[model samples]
Target chain A: MPDNPQVVLKITDLVKSFDSTKVLKGINLTVGHREVTVIIGPSGCGKSTLLRCLNGLEPIDSGQIELNGQLITAPGTNWSAIRQKIGMVFQNYELFPHLNVIDNILLGPVKVQGRPRQEAIIDAQSWLDRVGLKDRALSFPRQLSGGQKQRVAIVRALCMSPQIMLFDEVTASLDPEMVREVLDVMLNLAKGGLTMLIVTHEMAFARAVADRIIFMDDGHIVETAQPEAFFNNPETERARRFLNIFQFQELERRRA
Target chain B: MFMKAAWLTVSLAFWGLILSLIIGFFCALVRFWRWPVVARLAGIYIELARNTPLMIQLFFLYYGLPRVGLLLEGRTCAIVGLAFLGGGYMAEAFRGGFSAISRSQIEAGLSIGLRRFQLLRYVIFPQAVAVALPAITATAIFLIKETSVFSIVALPDLMYVAKDLLKEGHNNESNLLLVLSYLLIILPVSLFFGRLEKRVRFAGFGD
Candidate 1:
């Protein structure tokens, strides 16, 4: 890691709960500019909840989240303004089915940001081309495959030019072959130095692209380390067990 | 006379539908916001309007309100009464539409920096309209039929004209014309809405 990379996102003792069940318990972390941080955890470990809290989609019970030194999670904060700096891609594509692909990409910039439609369309077209879906711009979401929908979703978020992007198991819902195409887009973004926080089960992709891997269990982060070290020599028993499950799956795949 | 009355009936149902849609939209928002007092109040309003008879509601508006120093013309009372009644059912249909939307869709809108109102207008409303279209069309058909109750208020609507014509000893012809007039007005309108419902059906995932 470069010395003293500028901190782009800061989280301090974040706590979130749904009624009596606590989901995130006092999480503390920071992401440097253009760094890729991947969060790996079992289901119901609050990984997705953490990403949701960053953008104020889920209100925090306590603690502060600062984006570019602006207090985002504070009461009376303008969440809409904060959201402009952050983008999120869900496990489900969540594309507006009524809209064609180009319209879906342009909706945020045109509707929310008040950009002129023609100008947004010009910009949105380039994003579509970048994802290799320029030909399908006028096609409705229902006309696309799972991979194509996820690609459009990523392009939609990118159209906002957000400073930080969050991916919540974005490929979890895709078919095995489709997952590769979606991961490729993320890989291309990582190479371009777009700051991202991802919650994913794809250990290999995490190892390949992550600057740091944060392992979460229950509601707490059990360990944070570089991907190479985390996979080869996990520090905590929880991390080891988590890796073993992946290792066993990998072994079964090889034998088959 | 019957032709004039049919036109009046159509006009009442049309205006009543517009008013009901507007009221139902806001009421659905109130429920969605989940504010304790207002949501409960909205809930009560829906229940009250839905459970009571439309004829009684019109009677209250036309006859009962004068006692409270709020008198409206018979025509206005019928329109308002039908609107109030239809709004209750429309609110439920809209609420169902709103609920059918996946939580992630709203989250996606929020994450993309859409303000609450913008999110509802652009992303949420379009998808919801698709989900709720059939219900709304059903409500429209019911409201059109419910306008017959306006005759009780002596609004000179189709049914009122039929009743007057029957009482004046023009019995068989008036009854046959009344039924045919209703079919003529309602069948086309219902068919139009049914086609519209099909047109707006969402083509997205999880439909």
Candidate 2:
């Protein structure tokens, strides 16, 4: 898979530790061009850590990460430039409260990337339109519902024209109904051939959207398979137990 | 003469506050960035400013410094003392505001490829200033009140005029006038800050 010409992101022997506690232990993963790889695991299992490491949010202890064939983990790497290529939507929306929906989206493009304001605004509007938030250009974050804020966050990332997008449980904070709207936007992105590395607890959404599924536990990649295969015929005992919790609860509900 | 004194008092307070804001913001940035050696120096300055009275600091600047041939004029000493005192409070206010910005916000800014300075400029500052506004306003009011002590340096301030009028044996009238002058200065300022705070809240900043 490393030799595949379509690979856009390559992580090799990736290790991360937090104050003497190892969070990621020598993990190797590859995500190809337009591939949607969804990482699923129980809480505290380094799923989020891996995404953080990829985005340069958290520093890696050892190993290397190559994005579009450039070694990103090397010292003196220009993260500001590299980060422009990697867009991330957070679980908490994290929209700038000071700016309106459109301003928030245009900030990175206009201010950071030094693009013209009018051009950036046009691009931002198109992104907002795609996410069904075109009318919310002037609305502030406090003025929007949780789902709308999350969608604005997605639009904010898209305006930068990132090569890859990272979704770190983007729908995790939304209300049940709100989750569907955010997930739908992501589903469209996945289907439209955006290279995405998603960490999610939405088992069904993960199965539906992921081209490949990665099951991680205790800082190790336990299993990697196609979504349907991983969901139906998990190889590891740990993954089986992990999936059974959701399945068993459904079974209990049916029996009742 | 009395009007001149009142103008001096307002002018001194205004300039002192401006100086303190610059000093405080710079020191807070140093401490926040944890720049070794210099951050320790900022910490020490904050402690010394916070612990000492403005009167003592003024006395040192006006009288004591002359002993070392580092003489400063009375008005200059008063302004320096006010800035020294006010800077510490402003720094703490700024630090509180900066900390209120969560890790995720910075991460979001970084993910958008913001440089560190850009992060501070775009994301961190606008919200932090909103959260720190009330405290900064309080500091401004306190700095204005501290202008009363500038009389000790014999710079013609509101309190200096009052004390001179007492020497002329017009006690109650002078005392009444002093109280009225302070009321005039403080009232409008308080009302203005209140309105500003409300506007920011209404505009939905700091949330």
Write model 2 residue lDDT over A1-256, tens digit each, in one string: 1223577999999999999999999899998998889999989999999999998999999999999999999999999999999999999999988888888898899988999999998888888889998898999899999999999998888889999999999988888889999999999998888889999988989999988999999999999999888998999999999999988877896999
Give the CAPRI class of candidate 1.
medium
TM-score of 1: 0.95
Which lDDT tens digits does candidate 2 get at residues B1-207? 878888999889988999998898888888878999998999999999989999999999988999999989988998899999999889988888888889899999999999999999988887877788889899999889989999888788999888999999999999999999988888888899889888776665634
Task: Please provide the root mean square deviation of candidate 1 (C-alpha atoms, Å).
Answer: 1.8
State the weakest 10-residue window (summed lDDT) of model 2 chain B.
B198-207
TM-score (second chain) of model 2 = 0.95
In model 1, the Cα lDDT at residue A253 comes to 93
Top DockQ model = 2
Note the residue pairs that clash in candidate 1.
none
Lowest-scoring 10 consecutive residues by lDDT in candidate 1 chain A?
A1-10
